[model samples]
Target: MSRRGQRLTHLELLERLVSFDTESSKPNLALMDVVCDYLEGWDVPFVRVPNAAGDKAAVFATIGPMVDGGIVLSGHTDVVPVAGQAWTTDPFALRIADGRAYGRGAVDMKGFCALALAAVPDALAADLRRPIHILLSYDEETTCLGVADTIARFGADLPRPGAVIVGEPTGMEVADAHKSIVTYHTTVHGHEAHSAKPMLGANAVMAAADLVSELNRIADAMIARGDASGRFDPPATTVHVGTIAGGTARNILPKVCTFHWEFRGLPDLDMGEIPALFAAKVAAVTRERLNRYGEFGRIETVEEVAVPGLAPEPGSEAERLALRLAGRNHTISVPYATEAGRFQEAGIPTVVCGPGSIDQAHQPDEYITLAALDSGAGFMRRLIGECGAP
Candidate 1:
């Protein structure tokens, strides 16, 4: 096909992908169906690694010779919710105007998916000595664990690739480092009493307030510690409280109160440090505040999601390959976390490089510029050339 025809195909595939509301909360099986069918048309060998519940799956497709020392292109199939965002165009329907394509996942991801799938023909024609693998995973916006089962199969029933490139919108600039994110939900249990009674029951709301204040103190300490490497924005690990709710009436001592919070840590920071500090505070708060009224209440914390950080691996195969394909000499650090760390943890060298600007991701009327899409196509072409070499 001609160059123009290939670009058109790429846009069409993106349109199809965006049409599916593969929100992190919903199942991505429908989107996987379309992807599997496309790979089938190309005669690409692929595998479906489904979640334990079997409601969703990750599709791993291979082109050229199925062997070790290949390249893996990874992207998540899930997009964030759009319920409250004010979008000029339909968030799930692809709309092209002013040299850009607008959609929810167009820039955050799906764009790279289109570019990779569009190169299926070229990858086949390249007669590559090293295989090119495309991995579409689920739940990256939430847990980042959707790739775990597939990564586990590498070298067992599947060929383990030498490097992995997570296609998260980095404006085609290679990224080698990012922060880790862990989310938590804390609940305070207390006994109910009338507002007139001071010592009869513990105040859950007051206890929750103390915890939130402690979290702020922790956030301040994290800021003071700062990023030692000077690569992270905000220049420090960030602690945030997203939501808090509790209480029945203003006059009553609430029986339960819950708050949601998270901390994004620098790659070099010890992951256990923050949690340990919080645990100590929880103990103190439980003793001094919640149970001061003779075991009238307790505090409980549950970890919801923990996504590891991607550290800089300077001379790694993934970094070198991505930098070369992207026509750059150095790598960058993305402030956001991604599934790239999962690959690195599996012992595969990994980097993040893809089309479009992350500045457009997750916002209302999100878009990927046409020029960026074309640039991504160029990157894939060069990769095909590299893998095709004898």
Candidate 2:
């Protein structure tokens, strides 16, 4: 166990963690091991939930005994890729300038995770009444897949948390709700023929273009629907296609085209209905063209992840606790998605409240101010006082 008088510094922990490349595509087992070791040093018991490949895993640790209800501190371990970003300094190395820590995951979380880890010593020293659970997940940047296993494990052998605080960057404001994210990859397969003989082959690129047009139409319709909450910026569900790829050369007709698209829905919106509507529209058009070609040229859509939007549960215990701890009288909604939605889906009431601003997240020279970290550390101290040591 760590000496009662000794506590890990947030800057020290952040520097060590940032040294590891836990990018979305790479395995985070190394970083997980380091975290597990730190927890073990603090005499905290934890469980590792491994992915199907067994290369990456989520770490769930509890400072108190197995109880009916505990408070979970959740953050994703993965950072977005810095491949194309223009950075003045090394993206992976922690650079401190003007009391700000700049790194890849500095703002879009890992700073919050480091704060949680650093607070373990203080939490352990307290006389707690309820357990404080730490949940660090992987693959949050790509798809919210790492938390799925942890969510499934709850209520079987795992303790169900009474409330979950997802440490997504919110500048310490209380975020009661956020938009749900649904990503889809659509593949269009057509026939290849000489470019001059265009009629001899169905155009996959054209089919994809048609689908993109329909997505835009959906976005326009959603805008007309407007938002009931009036908190969100756009106030309605929005659809966008991020990437599209098709064709090899100008002379030859392309046989396949693929496009990646996403939808961000308001809390009250029906997330599943959007994709279903698009799929139906694509099916109708594809079938008509396939009949002419006498072959089944295809269009298929696969969901990468579906993070449900959190509906504000009025007077809920989670909301009350979060509001009280954050010293806030009101809660707000965001336009981005976080792991809080997944936790809520698992029957754990959740809120998003953490340090730093979303504006700095995923941008070049990403940073978190020292003031933000200090404020977050204070919140953790108060949480320990309220919950007590296990």
Candidate 3:
């Protein structure tokens, strides 16, 4: 039994959740174990979808009558790694001080997951005319690898809800728009020789520098393209290289160079333009550099993953329902990407609303204010009152 009046159940649940280190690189089965046990105790039937390796899984469950026109509450169980981050408190253990709870996933976003799990008892007690669904996914901290396969099972192995509420950190406001994300891994291959002989070998590092320069020029042009709505900061698509590795020694010319990069575009923006242009540049490098001695000099760019942005839909049923539940009359826009876009693309009206702030996400000593969780609790409580909700 959940003690809604006690106010500690949600906090306690968050503590328990953060205790398990479900970092994207590690197996999330332990966290899934806790979730399955909780749903079992509630006697709620759920569907489990595991990755091909069975190292991770996603859990989906429904509460109330088995019917259409239901609502789905979605959140991910994985958090980013705290490997090199400096923190005053333990990232795996929950700590409380100054009306804030500190932990790795406290704000983005085990806080919302705890609140959703803690509200099951209240939802069970209410005389709901429509059902409520819970979607707990894994590997969201990475490239949303876990949820992609799991969402494919929707409406086949699982009930297709009318609307989905993605519990990403939104400070308890309804968010209907965000930016799309596209990631790529680029590798340049060339012939190696001693640095003393410049003409004998093709330098991959130099080629990579040229590619990076071209990417910067494209970024500037995108900024010139501009956002007409003025909702996004900088009001343009942004490109950046996150990681790069190459070279064996300073004296030897680099034969291989690899880098991981991504671009963020506004909603409804065509994401293929940047990659297409980059491909053209890569071909030019390959054609011009390849010769009798440099037969292997080439470049390759592969799409790691692509996540669509959540588009703003005015007067959407999801918007109206979320506004009423959150006690707000309007919606807002964010610059982050969430699984809400996937649901929306699948024809399910979707919105993002949850606890905490995005600024605290992936930062040292991350915490969610007790007040923020209180606001989340109020939203969940109102969600349970669906019988009379607009």
lDDT of 3 at 175: 95
Residue-level lDDT tens digits of model 3 in 1-390? 232233347988899899999988888888888777788787778878898999989888888877777888899989998989999978999999999999999999899989988888788778567888888888787676666775686777677788889989888889998998999999998778899985688788888887888899899998988987788886888999998888899988889999999999999788788988898888777766533355658888899879888898888888998999998987888888888888888888999999999999999999999999999989888888874233
TM-score of each candidate structure, all chains considered together: 0.96, 0.93, 0.93
Worst 10 residues of 3 by lDDT: 1-10
Those runs of model 2 whose alpha carbons end farther than 4 Å from true positions after fitting are 1-6, 194-199, 248-253
Superposition TM-score, candidate 2 onto the true structure = 0.93
lDDT of candidates 1 onward, in order: 0.93, 0.86, 0.85
Q: lDDT tens digits, residues 1-390, model 2?
A: 234344679888888788788998999999988888788777788999999998899999997667868999999999988988999999889999999999989878999999999988877778567989999999887777779999998888899889999999988888888888888899998888888977688778878888999999999999999888898997788899999999888887778899999999998887678977898888876977633565748888888878788878777778888788889999988778888888888788889999999999989999999999999998898888889843
Screening candidate 3 with a backbone cut-off below 3 angstroms (N, C-alpha, C), the clashing residue pairs are: none
Superpose all Cα atoms of candidate 1 onto the true structure and report the RMSD in Å to 1 decimal. 2.5
Off by over 4 Å in 3: 1-8, 194-199, 248-252, 290-294, 387-390
Deviation in angstroms for 23 in model 3? 0.8
Identify the superior model by lDDT, candidate 1 or candidate 3. Answer: 1
